[model samples]
Target: MTLLFAYTSLYGQTLNYDVIRNDKSMGQTVVKRILKGDELTYHLNTKTELRVIFLFDIEYDLKETFKNGKLISGTGFNTLNGSVQKETQMALKEKFYELVIDGIRTEINETNITESVSEIYFEEPHHSKRVFSAYFGRYLNFEKVGERQYSLTSPDGTNVYTYENGICTKVKVTRDFATFEFILKPESLLAVRNKQITGKTND
Candidate 1:
């Protein structure tokens, strides 16, 4: 029966997810959909069109709305090259961030995802979002074991490991009976060479 106000993040990359009551009198908390674009799309707000251009696909004409601890909206078209992938509705809320995925609808509280991450700031060595790096607050670090694998620790001292390319593939957050999780895809680092080499083209 704890009532909480609203929460905001500093940057944007950090995702914020929370739990909320349905009727406020039902005495039952429900998982709500907040922001679909976490720290990756924090720059987007009302009256703004955020464009996410990926190597494989491009997302244009995107819209977002924030209210009542919930985020509801949809994109115009999701195209890989020139075709469309139908229209999909993307909705999430802050309250839902606190509850475990399955824990929300059922009594089971378990899911493999990170929930409610916000107020993130990038330090030195990272300029123009080209490279992503964080302090991890002295609590999170890289642990070496085999060849390409790592273990990431959360703020509450929870450890989640990955064993594919030594990168964080997923993040999970849970409190009381709620858990939220998210999978992260690696960013593209292919530089575009726009230099023209010429040795004096004679007549």
Candidate 2:
């Protein structure tokens, strides 16, 4: 499952979310969006650690650059157990998108330039098959289930996203016997932050 925020305003903002599994805090995700001139940059960072018989941890970092609503470049790295396992980079050429995975370059059709789960946050009408998964390194298809709900299916599992005011509030992914959920922090927290900012501005 992917956690994404749709920014309606050009102003920069950062979003924080808590990842949960079995009603317990598993990890957190941080997303930041910045706009400068005609370009928009998005950064996403995720970390998860599970301790059972042995300690297992994973981290994913991604950055995407968009110009005029089209993705121009992307780079990401994935680490498992504190060691980098995979790295990927992509750039849009004149007519095609070049993807390099672990030093291997592959040319992708220009029409399929859309390649990132976070891109769903910028999608129009809230439904599309143009979304991509970096973990799978392929595009996934999605269907709108409700006014503010959508579902995406991949070989690994199905992910359902619920949004509030176009911002993804909850995501549930079910794969076989495991189900994971990630939810936005309470609105009260956000309201408090806004109130503090407003108070400072007035002072």
Candidate 3:
């Protein structure tokens, strides 16, 4: 899950994907990134509902701020079945991260950041570590299987991601209890941006 895109200039981009489970559309996830000055901000939002024995719904949101390739602060909110499950805030200290979860304060080392998994997608290649999990959560291990294919393993299960031109084209998650796949839409962020610019100039 390494991204090799050059980011020397400030820009804002958005990626949209369809979340599918058992070949059915379950929800959608939107990831937005904004680069300004020396700071980069990433925001992810996901919403899904499943009608099984009962109506089950979930919503998750994550916001992270990074400076010079290091995480500075982050916030997370998660809801399941229409009830709030967790709310957290985190800030990086000298050698640790101070996390406030549900109003309870705790300190964690940089090795255990909750959003570490997301970093795997944006870091440079040939680094020391290829797999990393959440600071206090699940463990994730990633291995490059092919030119554009990667295998990601976690306590929950295993998943595979295929990327093309620095954009993830497909993701397959398989677990004992559930299996899901995320497919990138044909309309990418770059295409949308170019279309908007073209429309404005023609007007």
Candidate 4:
């Protein structure tokens, strides 16, 4: 539900991923980052469908705008089976930050929110060790594990990110319900070739 990201450039870019579980497609996640003068904005969305006792759908959205190097505001929603599970809105105030989660509001002194989890989808966080979570309204741990790989741990779960050439190639999200894998759309197309190379069966 969270990610770690850093700004590597001022240019804009978009990234797409296929959510997969047990060699089957569950849904997709799309992320975009835009630049306008000294301000930068990012959006992240994920939609998934699965069946346990019954079929259900899940959608998650997050939006944030930053100026210079400080956060201005952010909004997010998590919906499950057509019902909202969580919602939050955060904005910068004159003295501190204000956050409202599910109609309850609070004040935060963590004023400097430059980087967050969304950036991990586009740029490599080579020097970033921690990132703020817009949803959780707190900072989380991010650790570099291997070359082009990193791990993020939070209360919900732990996630692993894999990158190639500074772009995220895949992500493994661990949840209490199940493990979800987000593979870059372009890289996911290699499944067929991989089956042939390894002589494996998806079914």
List model 3 lDDT by residue over 176-202, tens digit each: 857788776668645443432111110
Q: Taking the tens digit of each residue's C-alpha lDDT, what string does model 2 give over 59-173?
A: 9898888888788888999898989998999888988878889988887776445446765443322456457655566778778787667899998799887754445657787
Model 4 clashing residue pairs (backbone): 3-117, 4-117, 5-120
TM-score per candidate, in order? 0.21, 0.79, 0.75, 0.83
Per-candidate total of colliding backbone pairs: 31, 0, 2, 3
Candidates ranked by TM-score, best first?
Answer: 4, 2, 3, 1
**Comparing 1 and 4 on lDDT, the stronger one:** 4
Off by over 4 Å in 1: 1-9, 14-64, 89-203
Error of 1 at 17 (Å): 21
The lDDT of model 3 is 0.64
Better of 3 and 4 by lDDT: 4
CA error at residue 123 for candidate 4, angstroms:
2.7
Superposition error at 164 for model 2 (Å): 0.7
CA RMSD of all predictions = 20.6, 7.6, 7.8, 9.0
Compose the digit string of candidate 1's lDDT tens values, residues 1-203.
Answer: 11221222222122111212221211111111234444233221111111235323223223333343233222223344445543333334433212122122211121212211110111111111121111121113334333323333445453332222212233333434333333332221010011111111101
Colliding pairs, model 3:
112-135, 113-135
